[model samples]
Target: MTDKSETAQPSGLPYAMSAYLIWGFVPVYFKLLSHVSPVAVVAQRVLWSIPLLLVIMAFRKQLGEYAAIFRHKAHLRNLLASATLVAINWLIYIWAVSTDHILAASLGYYLNPLVNVLLGRLFLGERLRPLQMVAVAVAAIGVAILIGDALDTLWVSISLALSFGLYGLIRKITPVGSVPGLATETTLLAPLALGAVLYFAQVGGGGFGDDVTTSGLLILAGAVTAIPLLMFATAARRMSYTSLGFVQYTAPSIAFLLGVFVYGEPLSTTKLACFILIWASIAIFCADAIKSYRASKA
Candidate 1:
């Protein structure tokens, strides 16, 4: 596993883009399993991801490194916290997409980078640039607009943003390798996930073993969950955080399009206005990041 602090050059661009692109399209994948209860779907995802992650760890010959993490109690505790956060994030996202709240899901991810910046300023003592601060303010206004419009689903967006933002922060501070860390998280969640699955099965609500297609899709959730994250971890280690942050928009943008076109979600004037504000804020934030990157290089 590479050190998180080690920075590679521009070579990670493709990896980062691929990861976000997959993430952007993931709504379609989840939609296929919309017949299942969102909670059960999440449980399946958690349960399935463990073996897939273990395989990756074994193939990479990083299994030893992963086992070593258990020896450190602090790392386990931090991972436990991160795992809980990610589970919440995942549950909300799955529920959003499954219930035709794709737009809210899209907005949540769109707001996530700004939330990340805010978390950095508040918790890490990192000072935000003027443009970045403006970006945060602008995003807040967009969110406020949604709230003002009585879009009760705004909680979905805010919760997703905050949970994922905090999860990233935890991952940043933890010295564990991404694959191993995620594997550990999944391992911790596995018991609960299994219990959920078993309970659902007992109640005849389990999607597994009902049909081949649903079963396969549920199983494939593991790959879908792990692969993009692994790609993201790779890109994060190899690229500057600014560049990664900029690329993060790809996923949400794709989701936005999917909501509008594919899912036929209604886009009211208020939603459009909010999206415009968010886009403008992102442009400003990216411009500042690019300027800073160039200055640092010089």
Candidate 2:
């Protein structure tokens, strides 16, 4: 079971396919949980997810990773902050999907790359190339085109994207592995989640069982959240960044299709134009990434 063969790339097809397909289908799951409040849903997701993640980590004897993390004050602080950012990101996404704002959610993810670019320049002190700057500018225009009176949801999308992008940046700099990092982050927030669940129950929110069906859907959110992350971690370790980044878009594309066709969300001419512009930005971004990657190899 040890993957020590240098010549053998781990079978990336399973990891990539599972992550993409599962992420693509996320809107359906959130739609099913529409009856539940977004806060409640997120609480349940985080609280319920901890046991599953912990059990897996325990079985793999990775409790030591958790111990190691707590010992490092710098890593611990960053993990807590990153955890909060991810929680906000998750809550906003669920709210958007539940309220039939799937296109907006898709737009957030589409803009995520540009947000990452900005963060790289601002925090990491990395410089962007001219084309990279143009790509980000085009993406901003695309986002503006999509913003038509849905100011609240649009802000939510932008905030979530930027927050998660920065969270990712911090996570990369933190001296922790994916599993341990996620576990610690989720662990830190588990108490708040548990408290919310209890408070909601007392307020007749039905907590975990407001409706049996909704409850089931909420539990399923854990698997939904965990699976893609696992796959992404696997894919990141096994494949090139270029390949992984390209595949990452599949989720949002699937979401766009689900939003426009299946969910019957409006794809106005303006929104369509926005989508096109964003896609063009992605094309430019990818070109730069590929060039950079190749240059490094050379």
Best by TM-score: 1
In lDDT terms, how accurate is model 1?
0.85
TM-score (C-alpha) between model 2 and the true structure: 0.86
Q: What is the per-residue lDDT of model 2 for residues 1-298, given as tens digits with 9 covering 90 to 100?
A: 1123312666565677788788778889888777777888888888767777788778767778777888888888998998898899888888889889899888887877677678767876768888889889998888887577456667866876787677767665665655667778878998998888888888855337766777777787777776676565555456543345456677788999999899999877877888899999999988887888799899
Q: Evaluate candidate 2 by giving its C-alpha RMSD to the native, one decimal.
A: 3.6
Clash count for candidate 1 is 0
Clashes of 2: 0
Q: Write model 1 residue lDDT over 1-298, tens digit each, in one string.
A: 3433234343678878999999999999999988898889889988889999888788877788789888889898998999999899999999999999999999998998898787777876768899898888998888889987747889999999899888877777777777998888888899999999999999976799999999999999999988887677667656545456678899999999999999999998898989999999999999999888899999
